[model samples]
Target chain A: MNWKPDKNKPICPQLCEHMSVLIASGEYNPHDKLPSVRDMAISAGVNPNTVQRAYETLEQQGLIYTMRGSGRFVAEDVSVSKQSVKTLRFEKTEEYFSQMEALGFSKDDTKNYVKEW
Target chain B: MSELLRCEKLTKCYGTKTALDEIDLCLESGKIIGLLGPNGSGKTTLIKLINGLLTPTSGSITVCSEKPGPKSRVNVAYLPDNSYLNNWMTVKKIVDYFKDFYEDFREDLAYEMFERLGITPETRLKSLSKGNKEKVCLILVMSRNAKLYVLDEPIAGVDPAARDYVISTIINNYNPDATVLISTHLISDIEQVLDEVVFINNGHIVLQKTVDQIREENGKSVDDLFREVFRW
Candidate 1:
C-alpha cells in the first residue's frame, strides 16, 4: 500500500489508522497475516520501532493479534472488522461536520446537502 | 548490555580550535538515531572519536562498553562522508578486501545487493558514478553485521532517487540488536526512519529526544523543529 503518513504528527497513531482502514476495507481480510515489522517499515519508509508501536496499538484495539512464533494476524472475528468500519465512518462524518461548521454551514444544512446528493 | 554507545564529557580539539566541546551522550541498541546538525558543527569530529580515528583531548568515549580501540573497532562499521576507497579497485576486489579486513563482513550479502543495484563486479570504482560509488560503500558497510553502524551523511550529495535507494538499503539491512547512528544535515528526508534524534550545535548537544516525543510535545516534525532550533 502507498503510505503517506503525516510528517507533523506522531507516526504511530497514523500507522494505526492506516492499518485499521486497510482491515475495515477488507484489503487485509479478517484472517490475513500482517506484514512483519521490518517489511512494514521498509514499505512505509518509517522506523521499525514506530511500526512495532502501531502493531501493539492495533493488537490492543482487537483489530490484530499475535500468534506465538507465527507473527501478527488480523483478528478472525468478522465483528471486529465491522466495528472498525463503524468507528471509521463516525470519525470521518464528525470531521466533515466540523469542517462544515468552520465554513459557516449549519448542521441542518450539511444533512440537507448530504440528503440531496 | 543494551547501551551500545556512550560518550562521557568527550572533547576534541585541533591546535587552537575545539572541534567538539564537552559532550555526554548515550545510545541504546535496536535504534536508528539521527545525529543532526548544521555543517562544521562537530558531527564528524564526534564520529571520528567514536571510530577511534582521533584521540579525544579530554574525557572518554566507549562503543560496546570498551574504549574506541581495536576491540571496539571490530564491532563498529563506519561509512565516512566522502569516498575513502582506492579508485583502481574493481567492485570484486573491494568485496574481497572488505571480507579480509572485517571478520563480520558478509560477502554474500554484498553481492546480493550488487545484483539488485545492477552493478557488475568487474566495474572499477573510478568508472562508476559518484552515487553508485556511495551505494557500494553503503552496501559494504551494511553487509557487516556489526554492533554499531556509524553512517556519516549517507543521504547527502546524492540525487533524490539515489537518496531513496540509500534509505531503503538501510531499512532492509537493519539489525534489531544493533544500533545505527546516522549523521546528516538533511533532516526531512531521513526523519521518518529515526527512532530518536540528537540535535548538536556549536560542538555541543542541544536536544536529545525520541521522534514521537518531539512530535507530541512540539506539534511538529523533527525537520521543522531542526529548522526552528538552528535558525539564524
Candidate 2:
C-alpha cells in the first residue's frame, strides 16, 4: 500500500493515487470520515475542486458516501476495493499479454517468463 | 420568473476593433450555459460586460431587472481567464477582501475549499505556482453564494487531470439555483454538464439552444456541432 508521488504525474491523479493507497493501507478505515474538502485541498496543494472531483469519483465507485452538510466517509465494505483492484489488474494483464503476443512471444514463453519471475 | 441575464444588441469595441457586435443573449436561472468561441472572438468581452468590469460601446445588458452595474456585480461571481488577485496578498488576506466585498461570501466555505486544495492561509499569492493560483481563485469565486457565476476559460491552461478536478469542483460547489455561464474552447469535457450551449464566432452568437434540443435536432453532441459551426 506504499505510495510515492511521481513528479511527472498531474496533481489530482497523484492525489487520487495517494488516497487509494491510504485506503488500501487501512489508514482510512471503512466508514471513517475523511478530512473536509477544503482541508484536504490545502494539504494536497491542489484546488479544492480537484479534491472534490476525486471524492465524487470515489463516491461513484462506491468506495465512499457523502452526507450533505456532514462529510464524506469510506464505504462500509471492501467489495468495491476488491472489485476495483481485480478489474484494474485484469485490464493491465490483458494489455500486457496482447503486447507480449504482438512481440512474437508464445504462451510457453509467457508461462516460462512468469515462472521465472 | 425573472431572467438572470439579458443582453440586447450588445456591442463592445476596442480602440479600433469591435470585440462583440450586436450580440443578443438571454439566460435563465438554474442552468449551466457554455459560451464557445475561438480566441479573440469576444467571449471574454461578453463575460466582462456581464460582470460590469467593462462597459459596452453601444447596447444594453441587464441582470435581474437592473443594468450591469455595482448592484448587479454584487450578485455575480466572476472568474477571469487570468489571475486577477493582487500579487502581494496572502490567501488569507484575499479571503478577507472577498468577505468585505461580497455579502454572501462564506469564510468557512473558503477555508474548506482551501483545505481541499492543500493551500494554507499563509500561502502568498505571488509564491503559488500558476496552477495553485488558479485553484485559489476558483475557491474564492465558488465560495460565494452569488446569483450568477461567470467563469471565463476556467480550465484553459491547466493539465487534463486538473481540468477534471476543476469541473468537479464547479459541480460540487455551485448553488443549484444560480446561473452559471462558462466560456471555454474545450467543449467536449464540459458539454455533458451544460444545460444550454451558446456558440459565438466573429463577435456574434451563431447558435443557442438547450443541450437536449441540440442533441435531438442536430443528432450530434454539442462538441460536434461546435466543431462543425466553428470549422474553418
**Top-lDDT structure, candidate number:** 1
Model 2, CA-based lDDT = 0.80
Candidate 2 Cα deviation (angstroms), residue B69 = 1.6
Worst 10 residues of 2 chain B by lDDT: B168-177
DockQ for every prediction shown: 0.82, 0.04
lDDT of 2 by residue, B1-232 (tens): 3489999999999989999999998998766788998888888888888878899899899987778898888889999989988999999999999999999999998999888888889888999989989989898998999889999999989988888778767766644468788999998777655667898988999988866567667767777878888788
* Fnat of model 2, as a fraction: 0.00
Task: Write down the TM-score for model 2.
Answer: 0.66
TM-score of chain B of each: 0.97, 0.94
- Candidate 1 CAPRI classification by DockQ: high
